[model samples]
Target: MNKLTTLNDHYALYVDGSCLENRDVSATTPAAWSLVIVTGDNGLGKGSGEILEETWGSVITDSSDSAFIGAEVGSNNTAELTAIAEALRWLLIDGGNRPAIVHTDSQYAGNLATGNWKAKANKQLVAMVQKLWREVGALRELNWSHVRAHRGHRWNERADHLANRCVNNQAPMPLSFWKPGQR
Candidate 1:
């Protein structure tokens, strides 16, 4: 297993984003960003794993967010940046004081947040996420980690599922653990 993919094992924060516009770029289609966050698991039963939030925003005109998203909101990079911004807001509200890493499959999102890469395409969205990252960092320890997308890792899979749900207009649901004839 690659070291990067093991972020779920070490960090409490994992965020993922999905964009519908990238998938179908039809002129009439709405490009929405679905973001999912996993805080961590406590090694307990049904309530062990806690997902902080599942957020969806229209890249074109998501009233939930400010108008700063600008004209390139339909881009996948913008969607990924939106997810990181949301996660940072949640961490600020959740009062995360300990060290935590934000895992993302989008290299653009991770690098922009971590300052490892400069923003060339989605300047507004990237700046927004970087701003949020700095704000969140002031309140707590934060790290950025990039992972391979579409892998079968536990948290990543769940994050991807939640992100896709927004495009499908489906609400986030709990994972079913019961299996028939498991005994």
Candidate 2:
């Protein structure tokens, strides 16, 4: 069973390898209306018995021009995408009278959001993400981009690191450690 644990907010975060920034939230602070999404990968291989990890991030310009809103983490593309959408829903939708933009590294997610492509095998996921996007989009503009991973974007680099950390921490132990007659 997964026990309750105190999670470090810094665990899946990247800011500048040099400095960490704090994100503050307030009841009246408006959401980030314009944003960018960046993703990172560690080259997981299902074949040849290799498995890698994924990470995600978002950067936004909040109602207060001086504040830049952002978040990043380690996770798979699918999970990361969902997390991004949900974050936007909370920040952009739950907040009143605000519109915003969403950017992403997943062409699959971006294309579906803009009606540029059809859903592939993951119809349920597509539908759910789309629903969230539309919900938030209703309040703001959501434009997406499919940026190449690890091309030296500051936010993308941090997000990638976080994603890799998440996957690395959750990876399954090697079969060599199995005990005799273990199921």
lDDT of 2 by residue, 31-132 (tens): 211122222311121112111222233322233433222222212334344445544555453465332333344566567645567765335445665776
Cα lDDT for residue 84, model 1?
75
1-183 in candidate 1: lDDT tens per residue? Answer: 123333344335556665664763432344445554654543121234566665555455443545545435455666677777767777777774755677678887798877779987767667777788888878766787666676555566666666666656776566565221111
Off by over 4 Å in 1: 1-11, 21-29, 34-36, 39-57, 60-71, 177-183
Say what the RMSD of model 1 is.
Answer: 6.1
Clashes of 2: 7
- Candidate with top TM-score is 1
Worst 10 residues of 1 by lDDT: 39-48
TM-score of each predicted structure versus truth: 0.72, 0.47
Model 1, residue 156: distance off in Å is 1.0
Cα error of candidate 1 at position 62, Å = 6.1
* Residue pairs with backbone overlap in model 1: none
